[model samples]
Target: MLDPELVERITARRAELDELEEQLAEQLAEVRAERDELAVAERVLERIARQLAE
Candidate 1:
């Protein structure tokens, strides 16, 4: 069994870990949005190229 002080420290550290996880999730969401925008831009460029070729 752990001591009381150690248990308290672990509890506090867990909260910090949770906060960090939330921050990471937000950043991942932003990255995914940017990736989707890039994909749309790529499709537009391809269409323009096909028009020029004809």
Candidate 2:
């Protein structure tokens, strides 16, 4: 059987990893949202430049 203390430590570490995963997921979502916004801004600029060229 595994030592009780070892098991407890493993459980704590797992919880910590779970929290880190949640934080990383949140950050990834924010990055994706910013990227999408930048893409939209780029498109708008392109359209403006085309209009000005004509």
Q: Which numbered prediction scores highest in TM-score against the true structure?
A: 2
| Model 1 weakest 10-residue run by lDDT | 1-10
For 1-54, candidate 1 gives per-residue lDDT tens digits of 779999999999999999999999999999999999999999999999999999
| Residue pairs with backbone overlap in model 2 | none
| Candidate 2 TM-score versus the reference | 0.97
lDDT per residue as tens, model 2, 5-44? 9999999999999999999999999999999999999999
What are the lDDT scores of the predictions, listed in order?
A: 0.99, 1.00
What TM-score should be assigned to candidate 1?
Answer: 0.87
Model number with the top lDDT: 2
lDDT of 1: 0.99
Stretches > 4 Å off in candidate 2? none
